[model samples]
Target: MKQWLQAFIAAIQFLTRIPVPVNVPFTNEVLKRSTLFYPWAGCIVGVLIWGAGLGLQLVLPAGPAAVLTLALAVALTGGLHMDGLMDTADGVLSHRSRERMLEIMKDSRVGAMGVIACILVLLLKWSLIASLMTAGAWQLWLVVPFIWSRAAMVWGMTNEPYARAESGLGSYFQGLHRGHLLGAVFSALMLSLATVYIMVSVPLEMAGWSASFAALAAYAIHPWWLLLGAPVLGMGAVWGCSRYLSKKLGGLTGDTYGAMNELTETILLLLLVLMTGWRG
Candidate 1:
């Protein structure tokens, strides 16, 4: 139990700018094991972003609130995933040899492709989030994508070989165990289920047991049920993305892992917006 708590804290410390007091040993083995808690770390980030979005919605219009919420999300992660996305774009879109592409990704300088990719992704995210907020669908479901996207990262690390030969952050997660993948999937499932129960099931219970069960049945058939498909979509996206990146750059890098997370989140948000029909 104590060791698991330490691992969770290590995951939090490693994944986000959040401060944690537990001083777990910082070793490759420890970091690999900490991958099990990646989804939980994402849940924490999601909760913070959700809270900030809600607060912003109170004082500002949905469009500006959505922009600020996206900014806060970026600030919270210190743009770690966004950097990965940009670096990946710079490398993979350079149309160079695999070796040269990897070299470009490793370079500290940003390229034209990377800058363009970042702008487009941020704009898309801002628009989708504003649409969701305007439609009043920005509820607990806001956190689901974050959980699954990190889970998708874990899925990539577990199944794909690390691209880089030299030691770096990505190498630490190479050859993850099946158990680690299972743990991440389980964590994501429990969190998503809990969110749905709290947001939907509990409210329906007040009307009576039958009404609650009926609501659950109706919800299962509703368009919103598509939200439950996020984990499957996220995993599929990660696998397809990893395969594509592997073909382009020989395998996945730390930057590509970040790219996968960002892309999965964006895809999930887009799906949700389409299903909800931009309510407001």
Candidate 2:
């Protein structure tokens, strides 16, 4: 139990800026094992974002709520994925040689393409989130996107080769075996189930069994059900993305991991809007 707790804490430390206030060994083997809890860390991020979204909507308009919530997502991860998105756009969209593309991604300077990609991705997320909030789709299902995004990163990292030959943060995860991927998906599923329990049991306690059961019935139409299939859908999408990026840059890099995450999160959000708000 102590060891698992340490692994989970290591995951939170690696994935977010959240101060866990625990001492854990930072080693290659620990880092590789920490991949198991990436989705678990993502579940924490998802729950926080969902709670904030709900609180924000109560006092503020949807537009400002969307902005703040989006900002919170970036802040939690210290803009790590956003930086990757920009770096990837600068490299992949530049149409340069594969080697040169890799070099461009490694460069710290952001280019025009990178800026544009960041802008577009943020805009899409902002619009989708605002629309969902506006349409009153504040179900726990919203958390799935956050969870799947990180899980997609784990899926990509475990299954794909590292682009860099010698160095880069992505290389540390190269030791990941099949167990890491299995554990990640399992963690994501367990997190989703816990969310279900929270959403259902809290309402049951506060409003009595009648109201709780009614809320349960509403799951028929809730996007939360998609949580069950996200492992398959998210991994498949990440696989296709890894292959595409690998064809261009030879393999996945740390930047591509972030790129995959941002893209997957946005795509999943778009699907949520379709599933919940686009009803006839």
Which candidate wins on lDDT? 2
RMSD, one per candidate, in order: 3.0, 2.5
Candidate 1 lDDT, 20-136, residue by residue in tens = 766788677777778888888888999999999998999999999999999988987889999999999999999999999999999989999999999999999999989878877
**Stretches of candidate 1 above 4 Å error?**
205-232, 278-280
The TM-score that candidate 2 achieves is: 0.91
On TM-score, the leading prediction is 2
lDDT (Cα, 0-100) at 195 in candidate 1: 84
lDDT by residue for model 2 (170-252), tens: 98777888888888888878887787688778888998998778765643344555645645676677778888998999889
